[model samples]
Target chain A: MQVNKSDLLRRLKKIEGQVRGVQKMIEEDRYCMDILVQLAAIKSATHNIGLAILEGHTKRCVSNAIRSGDGEQAINEMMEVLRSFVK
Target chain B: MQVNKSDLLRRLKKIEGQVRGVQKMIEEDRYCMDILVQLAAIKSATHNIGLAILEGHTKRCVSNAIRSGDGEQAINEMMEVLRSFVK
Candidate 1:
């Protein structure tokens, strides 16, 4: 929540574009391998975006919460989300 | 390419919607960890879709290629895409 988010938004836009590209590939009946490659790319793109969010949030939000003596709740919330990430 | 594609197309549409949902969350200034969770979900969704495509392609396309004595190329292509998937 504390990170600069405009860049993240832009990444999301690119990911949306990738998704649309895959749809086009499907419609045109492109090779399955080609479509699979694009899908993998989308997965990795989302992974990187999530990593960026986690790093920015940790460096800013988590640290600030700890300094303010509110670290427990922040940490708990982060862990839950982290669990979801691994799932 | 040999997979039943209508279901895959439906899955893609859902993924596109999910991407749009993430964009909305970003625009609304949602929590960073929450956004991270959504991104992780998107990654997994893509993974499942990729798996579906691979399974279908292998059972149909790969077998047909082998029967037609054209398997080496199809297999090599599938390997390349699988490598990309792991990346």
Candidate 2:
């Protein structure tokens, strides 16, 4: 979690623009397959953001928790969030 | 877009299990990079679910809106959701 918060937000903002672009493409009657391609790219970008967050969490929260002997609780909380994300 | 809802839910449930497994690996003090690799897998799984939803929305909602001459508004609504997802 020692990463620059603003950097992460900036990356998210870029993805926001891409999402808007995809919406516009859909509205403009773009080809179905083309739209799916754009959606795939957006999904990949989203996964990158998620990966960044996971890296931060593992490096900071998980490491700290393990050192403090609270790793189980921390992992449980992470599992909860992950389950929610998948849902 | 015509995909079975139950199938999607089933896939998500499996991903939920994978997420929990990753958490368990973390609690056992697995290597940092190994945890990141597991996280990467989870993120990819999540992206797959997102792709399915996006496909459904485009084929059903967007296509219907286009035929009904409400495509612009529908796209705007979709943009809102995309914004939230990136956030």
Reference-based lDDT, each prediction: 0.87, 0.61
> In candidate 2, how many Å is residue A56 off?
7.5
Off by over 4 Å in 1: A1-3, B1-3
Inter-residue clash pairs, candidate 2: none
- Give the TM-score comparing model 1 with the true structure, all chains together: 0.89
Candidate 1 lDDT over A1-87, as tens digits, reads 435677888888999999999999989989888899899989999988888788888898999999999999999998889888867
Candidate 1: tens digits of C-alpha lDDT, residues B1-87:
335677888888988999999999989878888788778878888999999889988998999999999999999998889888976
C-alpha TM-scores of all predictions: 0.89, 0.49
Candidate 2 per-residue lDDT over residues B48-83, each given as its tens digit: 656666667778888899999999997877766656
**lDDT of candidate 1 at residue B77, scale 0 to 100:** 90
Q: CA shift at A82, candidate 1, in angstroms? A: 2.1
On TM-score, the leading prediction is: 1
Output the worst ten-in-a-row residue range by lDDT, candidate 2 chain B: B1-10
Worst 10 residues of 1 chain B by lDDT: B1-10
lDDT of model number 1:
0.87
